[model samples]
Target: MAGRTEGADLKSVSPNQPGKDYSRYFQPPSLKEAKKRGKADVQVHYDFAIPEEMAGIGRGKHFLIRTYGCQMNEHDSETMAGILREMGFAQTDDEREADIILFNTCAIRENAEDKVFGELGHMKSLKRDNPHLILGVCGCMSQEEAVVNKILAKYQHVDLIFGTHNIHRLPVLLRDAMYSKEMVVEVWSKEGDIIENMPKLREGSIKAWVNIMYGCDKFCTYCIVPYTRGKERSRRPQDVIAEVRELARLGYKEITLLGQNVNAYGKDLEGGSYGFGDLLDEIRKIDIPRVRFTTSHPRDFDDRLIEVLAKGGNLVEHIHLPVQSGSTEILKKMARKYTREQYLELVRKIKAAIPHVVLSTDIIVGFPGETEEQFQETLSLVEEVGYDSAYTFIYSPREGTPAAAMEDNVPLEVKKERLQRLMDLQNRISLEKNLALQGQVLEVLVEGESKTNPDVLSGRTRTNKLVHFVGDKSLIGKFVEVRVTEAKTWTLRGEIAAKVEV
Candidate 1:
């Protein structure tokens, strides 16, 4: 710890580099400032070129980013990787070989943060062995005041800490951390601007994630996203469409338009009446084989979006509409802004528009003050909806959220029992749905080899069902027809019915 601050006041100057704004590094995330949705317009920057002085700073370095969170975080990691590569840093899967290691973290749950902290403790020896190695923490977790302060006090070896808003400033931050003895921390508390023309090193060529918007306005009481992510601001529709078109041209088979709440896209656009449905209507005409968007709020599932989705073509029939709770009373407590009947009505509308739709949702089992009757209401709703699948969780209290202050009346054993029941019910429903697909031929975009078996291949259908089949290595990126021969609770085993010649 003493070695960390040995030259804290000294700043090593890089050759030919101008002085930087050191005060910017002093800013840390503030929950109070993040909560405000001011009238200031979100500035859009079309130009995001890398600084010339730091262009080759990473010429002899390698980086490894351990990401934890949702698809949004995964996509953010891609952008950061692209930036690092542009600065001449190569990516490595092993931490031992990395000169700079970054933990792109998540703050949605306590367990996730615990896992990251455990890893940070494990990295202490590595930092001690290689004193020159730089360790950083970024992403949603870095956007919290408590999280940043905790790292400062406990993890003195961590040299860099930034947030989701200022990812475009990676080069500058990296340079500062590399040169300075003091820990560099820069996290924006307010909503960030929309940065265009940012580079990305996607995980794969077959499937991609394109972010259409940022932030969420629907402040669900149990959620910390609205604070960590800031106010909802969307990218220009033209920029989004252009990205999709370019992806299609690059032979990408699928793209999932990402957002904290995708349904409310384009609502923050100035002087424009366009909405998510309008954007979808445009992307549907692109040459991409499949298009999807996620993590929708049921309150924003408007009729226009349903009608456009019904047009089919590249718009896949799988919709991940998150209904956090089935009981209206619990939902009200969670501030979901919709009743049980309202959610069912929205589901009915979506089904009416697209009859073959495979519906999936999110459910929280034991929230604060939840009664058994309310839990039963959730079970009945699940039965009525006949959902293909669902992501269920026992409610985890997020710090700084409204629900965190509420009395956690639900006991630990009861919460676990309720979660078990919910998972059991959902697993049965999922198996039944998969059984119905047995002997039916479905179109699957072959992703890659199965993790467990090298001889077998893995892919997903139009409805986003994982199907494992034995195939040639060459079929990894092509769309093929597979007939389901066996069905399990979570996946489908199939044999190739036919192959599309590329």
Candidate 2:
């Protein structure tokens, strides 16, 4: 019962409590409470309006948001930005110029945490220079007690601290930090009710992130997302369909439905009859050019979903199914709930249904008890799958996870060696996969100018492969056919063949 922590034993706190004594009104993160799964009904709220008193509080002020980690965090930042914009706060990229600064953090890895702390230390000088400036930390990191405790002890200049459940209340938290002498802390330990109609200041018109659901319930042993994100809850299908229709009407070229475990959508609803497949089947008929979903759990990926994706028009051919390990024993230790054979069988089904499907995956090396033979199995699996790309990482324990308590017998050098081997295999497979596309024509949705070379424009094919070519800047948001001339390990060099009619 991972991520089922409804009615968790949280510290009682009054809403919008403001003061120095954070413990009085804050429900800080607790692993014990987070593991509890009560039968509380998941709540849904349609109204989410900014507080009347704080409506104009951000007038004549500029804010900056530094986002880290997954696409969900990026979308959360967009919602926060939309709220701030409603309060009349403009956005700034320069740290020195911003009157308000917020760090939207991630807690998936220790390295990400270190980078955030390093940036916070640098921000100390900025805070001292402008004493009136308000600084905040939100997202998954703030949902952890240890992280919040460390911030309180080390980064006292931080004015506000909130968590994932209560982002819609940012106006109140920001206002309290501005007026109160002490830090304002208001974090909910339980899963939040669904809040719809929140404004989003998306990064680009070409691509957008639409969150169809929130939280995870699978509770993988090596992960902290279950606790930090709370239990599984989904937005109503009508709400989701309406949002997609609106995005289509607005001329958005692509919309990726996001979730911690996207394939588990609609399970926590009242009747629980509908699911992600049914939703996708409905979304595929929309006028939008392209649609995608991410971070799927293999256990929840069933035949219905695969069938819907097969009759694809707007549903892209790319699937990012994360197989954390290739060893059945390792997956058991990680609580992935699926065996190696089952995963391969799922891949087989997908390949049979969609002939030209471009598959990608996530792999982790050096789990606490992983052996050399287990590592080799991963390499063999990578070669067998022939994934177009893979995200590989060395295993690092997070404090509150069950895996952290296990004996970490694998040494650092061993972990690094294993990771390198995994990457090498995946890289070779990627190059081979891309090289097959040499001279093949692809429809690329032009995102924008290439980050490295402005003279060249960059885009992604429907399968989510990156392609770069020399093109007019005006083609930023349109789809065009490109002839792939050269293929590298990770990217493709291409030339525009024809402009696509919208």
Candidate 3:
């Protein structure tokens, strides 16, 4: 069920690669030229012929990758891990025990970059102790020009720096880094290519992440994703279905279809021959038990998808639709392409279609020019929506985003206060939502033990409510029906359902 590739191989058995560390090509990435790489209508043809073997260049070396940000980054880490495994590198959790440490970073927030730098600083002493250690930084953060310059100037200990594009060239890059005297930095911001056949290592047995598409087209003013991730490119619908089929064959019960804007899938290819709705319909035919998707854009979300969800058997009763703000002015300013009224209408339609559907969203407390009136509008929207849950954060401007250039008149104190107020509202709403579910029997897929109590197992219902119940360790990666005994803001306490009907 694996997707086939269309790229021609550029064959060359290098003198020193994979195992041997002889540098033939090692050069730093030019951040200056990367700005123009993600323009619309750019055709990105992938290079699929990764060397079947890398001449054992990474043999006897230890490698570790710490990933940050969204599911895209998490999936990228899996791909990178696969590449590392192919290169003969052993995995390690401890950086002190590893010969190579890679930070698969995120650039969504300023704090994320700060955390990365702080870790890089900690690794400087480690690098000083073991000069042979190959420290690298990849993923979204490395795509930033300023971040890379800071790494090159201040954090010289970093040995490799590649981007979202050209991860298939990791073997080539790794071989170069092994023997080269200079740091290897090649961050390509090209419109991302559809790379199939990269070996993937997923964490969970029951749940898996299948990327339906890559990159983003919506240049939301406050977002750096379009720049860091590149233009929207969907994996062919057949290819996506094939992967899902494979996962189903392997006993995976659930899969969260991964994408920056999932509902925007298939718009870029073959003149809209197939779309996210069509893809979901095809996926539903597959034998998987549960299907879910995330980070959907409200503008692209249409009646077709809602209709499909309404007719669901395998599709879960949960949707994470991110309404970044509630003010029409804010939405317009953010270039979200959907008005607050439009968003609320969409929500209404979805709820009408599926009465038990649980809705979650992401909300930013304070944007650059947001006034108290606009903020109040946001609060009103929250109350109106009565969201099942929400991820609320104070606005943080990304450097290259359009919002960054605007005057951030909203004080930090004000932003923090708004954020707290938002959280307080959302928490109360969440508790109310869960409280309504109390005493109901829910079918929970046991993912793992509860973080707070090992004796209890933790899993989520099809409605995506987290339920913790007393269970054995053997129940992990299995499904069970639990009766809700208690309800809280974030999670529920439940027990094995009795034979008696509710």
Give Cα-based local distance difference scores for all models.
0.87, 0.88, 0.81
lDDT of 1 at 251: 92
- Over 368-450, each residue of candidate 1 has an lDDT whose tens digit, in order, gives 99999999999999998989999888889888788888999999999999989988998999999999999999999999999
* Better structure of 1 and 3 per TM-score: 1
Q: Write the per-residue lDDT of candidate 2 for residues 1-502, one digit (tens) a residue.
A: 0011234443322223334344433344455766686578877788889899988888899999999999999999999999999998999998888999999999999999999999999989999999998998999998887787677767888888888988998897787778777767667777678889888888978788999988888888889998889888889999999999999999999999999999999898878889999999999999999999998999999999999999989999999999989999999999999999999999999999999999999999999999999988888888888889999999989987889999999999999999988888888888989999999999999998999999999999999999999999999999989999999999999999999987
lDDT of 3 by residue, 1-502 (tens): 0000113222222322235322212212232333344435535444455475574667888789999999989999988887888777878898888988889999888898899999999998999999999898988887776777667667777888888877787888777777777677676545456778787777767889999888877888888888778778888777788889999999998999999999999888888867888888888888888999987999999899999899888888899999989899999999999999999999999999999888899998789999999999999999998899998888888876778889999999999988888889999999999999899998888889888888888998898999999987877777789999999999999998732111
Point out the worst 10-residue segment of candidate 3 by lDDT. Answer: 1-10
RMSD of each: 4.9, 3.5, 6.1
Model 2: worst 10 consecutive residues (lDDT sum): 1-10
Alpha-carbon shift of residue 485 in model 1 (angstroms): 0.3
TM-score of 3: 0.90
